[model samples]
Target chain A: MASTKTEGARRKAGRRKKEDKASTADLLLDATSELMVERNSAEVTFADIAEHSGLNPALIRYHFGSKAGLFMALLERDAGGTFHNLETLVAADMPADQKLRHHVFGVIKTYWRYPYMNRLVAALSLESDSEAARFIAERFTRTLSEAQRRILEQGEREGLFRKIDPTLFYFSVIGSCDHLFTARHSLKFAFGVEEIDDDLRIRYSDHVASILLDSVMV
Target chain B: MASTKTEGARRKAGRRKKEDKASTADLLLDATSELMVERNSAEVTFADIAEHSGLNPALIRYHFGSKAGLFMALLERDAGGTFHNLETLVAADMPADQKLRHHVFGVIKTYWRYPYMNRLVAALSLESDSEAARFIAERFTRTLSEAQRRILEQGEREGLFRKIDPTLFYFSVIGSCDHLFTARHSLKFAFGVEEIDDDLRIRYSDHVASILLDSVMV
Candidate 1:
């Protein structure tokens, strides 16, 4: 009985250790996100992140392996579920138009919730090494584009959506979805929109989905 | 005859002096543009600009007043004509749909020619003082949005366009127009598109115009 209790204790200890590691990583990521959003930039450094997280900078290097790895991990943490949900939506039994509209809303809301995401993706893809860039493209861009392609194809098959190049559609739709969030200064200065509250986000989402649906619908 | 010759020589000297000043300023602007394009950033220092232009750094301060002034000047040089032409286009006798399609093409082409233009505008607006940001919005963002509002209103009145918010349209259209250029690395990594040639630009232009026109048309 003592031997069995010892084994159980060891397993419990192992699980507790793993949970501690995961929580520490999450704390680092949360700090990174906060710093990036507060600064409105993806150029936040390890020192900044360390100070913000109140953790040793060495912990970051240990957890993420490198800055590129940390960024990639952050992308995965923030957007992994989003991309996964997109695939599920694509596979679901909904009509093409409905799926596309939902996809549009999801993209906008994702940006709304994490204003630094698309910018982070762009920065990583632009400045990181080729391997990191490729990983990002494969994990994020390609997945989104592929899901879009499937939806476009499905819509065409359903005789609902007009034939459009999925590649071009990817750029346009993604661009339109994220613009309001990205161009916050333009909103403030040009339109006197000082804040992007939930109401504004919904309104903008409806506007984008409306126009895009109109463009693609028969 | 001697008095006439003296006056002529003095005038000639004055003209030469003015032309020399103008050319030196132009040289500085040209060097700034070249370095920005080469580095894909607007963070180029005054020292870098001076070294590239082979002009004393003091000349930049003297000619433009400050870095913000220099950026503002660059915007005027690059986009001033585009905005002026947009005003002309709005007042033209063309049909609303045709005008909007042309505007879409114009926007895409502008970003293509000056890939750094929008990014520079965003950076200036985000990082600079309120005065500079306000100036940029007044000079560029408001002008673009107002032209779009006029076009949209014209389209609605002419029974050619569905009602849409001009502000939302501004974000969507500009976002769509500039995405391909800004997401260059995404294109390279995701689509294996290493270069954005005229062919791609023309094709993308047609695609954006078609969808946007379709969305807005009654």
Candidate 2:
């Protein structure tokens, strides 16, 4: 066991560190995100995180306590960043439609960065009484829904958008983008693509933005 | 151990059987489908399957070989029914838009009846090398995509539809409906709905059908 740990330590030592100088917690979160995308949340393990990040298992325990803790931290980081972007866009001087388009693109880009975030959010929020679920509802879902409502109202006032249910319409917009990355593998298979390259991601955002705006634009 | 097995056997035998009198294999598949919906695919277990169906573990092993096998059988059965419905609609003498509407409703109903089908399909197809993955690709994904293509072409040819990419349009239609059911719990929490009742299901089908047709109907 001592020799095995030493060998593991030596191999980890041989690896180059991240150039951006991400914190240990952030590195662990990124590793968890990658594993979730590959094998999903349920299949991922703490050992997988330790191995994937080449960090000490004790360090992971010290930072996050558990895999669930790490996953929630990841969600808080990504979803909070996305909400911040939406707030910035909403505060911008752009028109309602453009703001809405940018909002949708922002969401797609977030999911693009963390492909498994939607699946994780859905799983965590469903039948869960944890802080993660509450954070998602308050910081992510409700905040985004309210932002969309403001956009919809502004568009209607400006006579640039049709009257639509903000809840349902936002769900449609989100489902459209969320399903793309959440179901990326299947969609790729259905569309006969070997991978979701950058071009396809842009095309998908364009497609979803067009569909959402077309449905409500005057 | 002998006494425990006897107790289990007695309980299993005392449990009332289904009126329709399904075979053990059919019972196993139905039980698995129920569990997948209730708990999603990642959380199900062979013990859970045996407990839910009141069948012996040996019987499950004997019939389906493994839990994954039972899941594939359920997918095949459900996807096959959906395809059958689509084929029937396509062969009907109805107009292209009507056929497309029916197809959309058919998908919504399928997800309603088997709420976890989309999640299961995505999970299974992501990194699976099993026959379940292949069955989903050939029977579920390909069949549905092909049907959508035919409907799109027919609608355009009949002068009732605008030109659209069938792949992306189909993704939106499916994403709209599939998201509602797959993330029913989260959406329920977000929207403050206690449940998605029949009225909501009808409203959903109508909403999806309207959204899809509105995008394409000329």
TM-score of each: 0.93, 0.86
Colliding residue pairs in candidate 1: none
Candidate 2 chain A, run of 10 with poorest lDDT: A13-22
- Native contacts kept, each candidate: 0.72, 0.39
Compose the digit string of candidate 2's lDDT tens values, residues A33-90.
7888777443577888889999887877788776557667788887876777788777
lDDT of 2: 0.76
DockQ: which candidate is best?
A: 1
lDDT of 2 by residue, B63-113 (tens): 777666666777788778677778878878888999988887888889888
Per-residue alpha-carbon lDDT of model 1 for B1-218, expressed as tens digits? 99999999999999999999999989999998898776556667899999999999999999988888888888888888688789999999999999998999998888888877876786677665777788778999998889899999999999999888899899999989888887777788899998899999999999999888988998
